[model samples]
Target: MHAVLLLMMMVFAAVMTGCSSGPDYKIDIIKELYYQKDKPSPFEIKVTEAGKAVTGLTVTADLSMATMNHGTVKVKFAEGKDGTYAADVKVPMNGKFEAAFLLKKDGEKTEKVIEINVVKPEGVAKINGQWITDKDVSFYKFINQLQLEINRDAARKNYSGKQLEEELAYLDSQEKVLDDQNKLLTQIIRLRSMALLAEEKGHKVEAAEVDAAVEKARGQYAQFASAQALIQHYGEEKFWDVEKQQYKLIVLAQKVQKDLVDQAKKENPKAGDQEIYYQAQKQYEDLLISQINSLKIEIL
Candidate 1:
């Protein structure tokens, strides 16, 4: 066990001797095991041999608590792109844990042990190394549904029979897929990046500002019965709790937008509101790209 811990700490050096292999397999951690209770926590790793990726190797892990006596759980890895392999490991709880990885190819068998600290997932991904929590994902899903439900209600009222079915089908077609999920994650990243830039520019998101923004949204949605029903379904207090956090960032971004709009207006004194807004939006996108490039982003 002490030998295992030592090899785990070495990270890139854990290896085994095999007649058919070159330079001993180098195992690297791609993603760590995260705590998900009895649910599967994703663990990813990359395998290399002789300075090149080695594919078609079978891999598995025996997971066990490091500090306490918890029975070992076994998980098998499925091959992924390149030399990457991933496994969904189920653990008894979140804490210090260790995994003993067994890799096999041809007649060669290699074992690599690694220490993994299992904690609650910070986020589905990271922005400048900050975790994007499950809460963020849920809120995005909810807010998107708010508009969809409203449209659904509108279709029910204005269309009937086959026409209604077609409208409903169109709405269903809009349901989120992998691309939409990526888009939402990108949006979350963009908003956060802009908000951080706003703070750097000395814009403050006060509680009053957040409250006002949220209230404005509430008032706008209040006209739609479907919106109200959705809010009720999530519990109004719970809905607003997440919403307020979202609006705080939003308000900060809005401040940045307002600054850009002000700049556009000054430059185009004769421009109408729409023209000014369009200019500001273009500037905002350009600035967002610069910010994203300058920052370190990681998708976990």
Candidate 2:
């Protein structure tokens, strides 16, 4: 009789527990996405339900365009500390790109479409509206590497914990300089794509020139056992790839400037213009150096 009574009680408890539990809430991706700068460029995307948060939700973005093609980027929704779902999608080219977000929860899936324009970049105006080239990234990366080296040196010298911490804090401040430069560069590239096209059409720099520039830059690291080892540490293909890209951009910008000067000369032949092409080339080289410095590039 007692066993029967206990069983009845357990059954009642199980029923009550089921009744107390609430239904799983549903989250829908509402269309709101924006880049850091634009208010209405349609870069905002979100999934929300009752102001709560969701994690591990998958978001995929795809783009359809008449000129450029972009496929989906698989991203998992990362929960913000404040309980919001977020994912980052890097835009590839400037055009109208359609994005779809796929959300999976409780073995069910939901998807939505949001369209955004990959506008040509219009960041802060610098000298001549030059597109931020890969070289800008390289310069920023070089500064980061320098800071790392300095921290390593300070450690080797056996600085006090407090002193080392202070030094590291100072280094941290400089790190953001690169981040800002990178953001600027992204905008510049977007704005100056036309100039880039012109450069791509007119001139090509040889691979050997790029290789030589990279090798010369590596001289600062001669203390390392081998250049190969340094390259391996930095990444064999990636470091060299960045160098190649920078050199190509350099060549491209030079050609574009020359094209401009050439047109000017053609428009006025008897003005005794000193080799406008050569003059343009020199001006571009100087500008490159100035831009590098402005970007706070330091080789540690």
Best by lDDT: 1
The models' CA-based lDDT, in order, is 0.84, 0.53
Clashing pairs in 2: 32-44, 32-45, 33-43, 33-44, 33-45, 34-43, 34-44, 121-190, 121-191
Across 1-300, the per-residue lDDT of candidate 2 in tens digits comes to 999999999999999776542334344433223233323232334455576655555545454554565554344556543334555545444666665556556656665665556554433223343433445555546635654565556554666688877776776676666567546454344323433454446566677766766677567545444444546777767776765665566555656676767765776676456666666556555654544444422110
Best by TM-score: 1
Ten-residue region with minimum lDDT total, candidate 1: 14-23
lDDT of 1 by residue, 1-300 (tens): 999988786764544222334337888877777776557767788999887998999998898999899899898999998899987777888898778878988866777787878887777787766888777877787788888888898899899999999999989887754236677788789999999999999999778888889889999889789899989999999998888988888998989999999999999999999999999999999999999998867564
Question: Positional deviation of 122 in candidate 2, in angstroms?
Answer: 19
Where in model 2 is the C-alpha error above 4 Å? 1-172, 181-201, 221-232, 254-300
